[model samples]
Target: MTSSTPLRIGVMGAHSTGKSLLMRRIEMELHGQGIPVARTGNLGRRAALVPLPKMQHHTLASTTWVIATGIADEIAAWARLEKGPVQVVLADRACWDALAYFRAALEWRQQTAPRAEREALHQLAHAHGRTYDLLLATVLDPDVPVESKHDYDPRYRTLVDRHTHDFLREENIRHVRVTSDPASQELAIEHALQLCMTEAPA
Candidate 1:
């Protein structure tokens, strides 16, 4: 099951939306099944520069560079190194999430940053959306608390979801929604694996 193109999957959602948990579960499940899987996430509290966890073995660049450069070259670089077919690369924060976060952050930055800098950031957000493959969105249950006040804006989450949907639809990328349920996570994982395996040599 060697693929010509890498299998890139993004587990994305707002704060405390269980994105990290889902990623961990998926990695464990895949590894248990003897699949080659790599999982990583934003381990730091600061969004400006978050590093991937050590368990994933991925050397992710700072979010600052991702925001500055419209292209997701860091992730792209890692994706190109598959020794065999069907290498699963899972990231907590993908280009889609980065775009969503950037859009939300834009409003706050607009109040302080110069006009040129604001425009550049917006362009970067758009570029991020164009580079992603699949987007797995997690819908949060109402009972969970926000990880941080800055990441808790319901309006931003809604807007980001809408934008994400548009990008997926426009690009024709596979997008799936998983509620805060273990069963749902299992189903999503199966579907995503099928897509990765069944897609044309990629």
Candidate 2:
């Protein structure tokens, strides 16, 4: 990347779209290319050792807490990478993903968060989202289904998928959509690399 600062990226998609696998593969490929890469894990895995506010309860407040933790984790990793010569900070998910899930879940439950609160959350997420240099999106493939304990039902996945797609389109966020195939995956990595290389680190 042209930017001296590490490229901050968000790897996002609907639930069980293999984002973690993509994140790990991308990290490996980047490291192989000698591009220093650090990754932030899902809500709990990467920061498991570090105590977080109770996020298991997925209320609006809890989801907002999750978004804060995600941003905080990314920033902390970015700060460390700056000291070393790391060129990219790859995050498992971004704040926008959280917002999508938050809204999707609320809708699924037929519950509505107040407009002011929801708008505030969106604004907050959008502000933090600017920190991203590139966003890699995983497009869901019905042909290749990954097993999931929580998202076993295709209907829920479809719902989240719809919301994710709708929000991404609405925001017109700059992103690369990776299909669920090896060839597409590699191509996405190529595109992701190209995108990362274009970011100017602040």
Candidate 3:
């Protein structure tokens, strides 16, 4: 937060796991304190418009596009400070999110991505991930039904959640995990606020 670049807070998880809701809560809290934030999101919807495969059918190309585009979006969000100061950049999906979805897709299809290609993507995601000041990853709760509006494949969704955490652990990336519980959500909000407010505008 002390850096001229805005503090980047990213949230990542499965499609229906409340990633957006958690980010929205943080955004509201920052705004209440008069902290400016820029959010980058809707990557999945945007990818589909690009006619790239997603979800259960996510491919290496699509995954690459998603991650690279997310990086660009984050850079753009940071660049917004030139026009006006933005204290934080709230990224709806962190760079590794697409890789997780792709990993899940491979598992769902019983296919394996080439070792080199997979490793390269991981390197790219890992590099971008280091820039985040705070990252929140949501845990999927299968007991809670997804809203009918989203026609997600339960099996695919579960795999995505599993792989998301798997990648986090494997990479040893530091992040706070948010669950469905209200208490967990509140703690995450507090943690994020503390990170931003420490160097935020008074």
Q: What is candidate 2's lDDT per residue for 1-202, written digit by digit as tens?
A: 2236677878777767888888888888777766667788768443334443322224666667768888887777767734465678888887888777776677766788889988888887888897687787888787875765553556556667777778888988888788788898888777767766666243
Give me the runs in candidate 2 sitting further than 4 Å from their true place.
Answer: 1-4, 44-57, 81-83, 148-151, 197-202
Q: Residue 52 deviation, candidate 2, in Å?
A: 9.4
TM-score, per-candidate, Cα-based: 0.62, 0.84, 0.95
- What local lDDT does model 3 show for residue 181? 94
Q: Per-residue lDDT of 19-82 in model 1, one digit per residue for the tens?
A: 8877787777767766666665643344334533211111123334544332344355346545
Q: Which consecutive 10 residues in model 2 have the weakest lDDT in total?
A: 48-57
Model 3, position 60: C-alpha lDDT score = 86
lDDT of 2: 0.73
Model 1: runs farther than 4 Å from truth?
1-3, 43-86, 107-133, 146-174, 197-202
Error of 3 at 13 (Å): 0.9
Alpha-carbon shift of residue 70 in model 2 (angstroms): 0.8
CA lDDT, every model vs. true structure: 0.57, 0.73, 0.90
lDDT for position 153 in model 2: 55
187: Cα error in model 1, Å: 2.0
Candidate 3 segments exceeding 4 Å error: 1-3, 81-83, 200-202
